[model samples]
Target: MNAEPEGLTGTIAIQVESDVVTSRQMVRKLTRQLMFSLVDQTKMITAASELSRNTLVYGGGGEMRWEIIERDSKWGLRLAFEDHGPGIPDVQLALTDGWTSGKGMGMGLSGSRRLVNEFELRTAVGEGTCVTITRWKS
Candidate 1:
């Protein structure tokens, strides 16, 4: 993550499955604007897609916030997915591989973590959940 101040780039409302696709497209566009390689762009887009889906499906709808960050001379894209739905009862279990409470493959959180440069998860049992991820251009 960068020590420099981050500038909010955009936000996408995630209320439906189509919003997940929109999030991915927006992230891909941002990554390309930052001159990220194709692989990096794909990684961010994939992570955004998964997180956005989680927000809509599990969180019952929320939003995705994005920022353009600078660290040293390099650029990065940061995304945060938030929802006010029922939060995970066990954060640790939710993060484990192949552990899902829904029909998903249980790769949304853990897999997104592996695809980005930074990963963060915040949740309250009855409140909601927020997952943040960052991918630095290489």
Candidate 2:
């Protein structure tokens, strides 16, 4: 598992509908524990909900793994979602606002990127896709 050696929080499978709900709950709880404000908590939960859904609906299901990390004397939560479905054909266009591969608002990637301090997406045709995002607490 991709990890933050010091502060592993937990990991959840993004294989079904329930997983998305569970992921949001997990992110909310973790964000709160890290002393994140309600607004930040909402943003984190929303991002997790969207990404977990994308993992299920678009990526044919995968996993969401999270960990706590410390950088520059500040703590943060890191989440990673992975899937083995058909990879995104055009990541650049995908990041564009309103671009939808499915029925989504196409906000999953771009919106989530905005909600976090760090965002990274990796994909390849016929290979798979993985997204990692981190939200920091000041």
Candidate 3:
């Protein structure tokens, strides 16, 4: 898969796991290449970790696509996570913190949304879910 505004791009496939600790580690490794400030990279890594866990737990399995983009002299990173499991029936409800379908903390979606500069999510009952997040250089 291709992420727009391309600079550096990569993809990772993850399986259903309890903690998704490996996925979070991978995000941190990839984010390091972005050359972001320490604080910014930390936030991006945190968001990516949270979303990866969500996909693994809720969607059964999924993949994350990462890319660095440059637009109008601005640089940023973009992530697209896709999964093919029982989809979310109500996006709004799912986005609400503390609202979970499983034994999750329910902050995955909302917290991730807040951590990035741009966020978009698409989900359906059986169609699956796709979440895109972007963090730009300040």
Q: Give TM per candidate.
A: 0.92, 0.92, 0.87
lDDT for position 117 in model 2: 83
Clashes of 3: 1
How big is the positional error of residue 128 in model 1, measured in Å on the Cα after superposition? 0.5
Q: What is the lDDT ranking, best to worst?
A: 1, 2, 3
* lDDT (Cα, tens digit) per residue for candidate 1, span 12-129: 8999889888888888778877878888888888888889999999999999999898889988888999999999999999999999999999999999999999999999988999
Per candidate, the number of residue pairs that clash is: 0, 0, 1
Q: Which ten residues in a row have the lowest lDDT in candidate 1?
A: 1-10
Query: Which candidate model has the greater TM-score, 2 or 3?
Result: 2
Q: Which candidate, 1 or 3, would have the higher lDDT against the true structure?
A: 1
Q: Per-residue CA lDDT of candidate 3, range 37-77, in tens? A: 78888888899888888788888888888877888887788
Sequence-dependent TM-score of model 3: 0.87
Candidate 2 is scored at a TM of 0.92
For candidate 2, the per-residue lDDT at 69 reads 84
Clashing pairs in 1: none
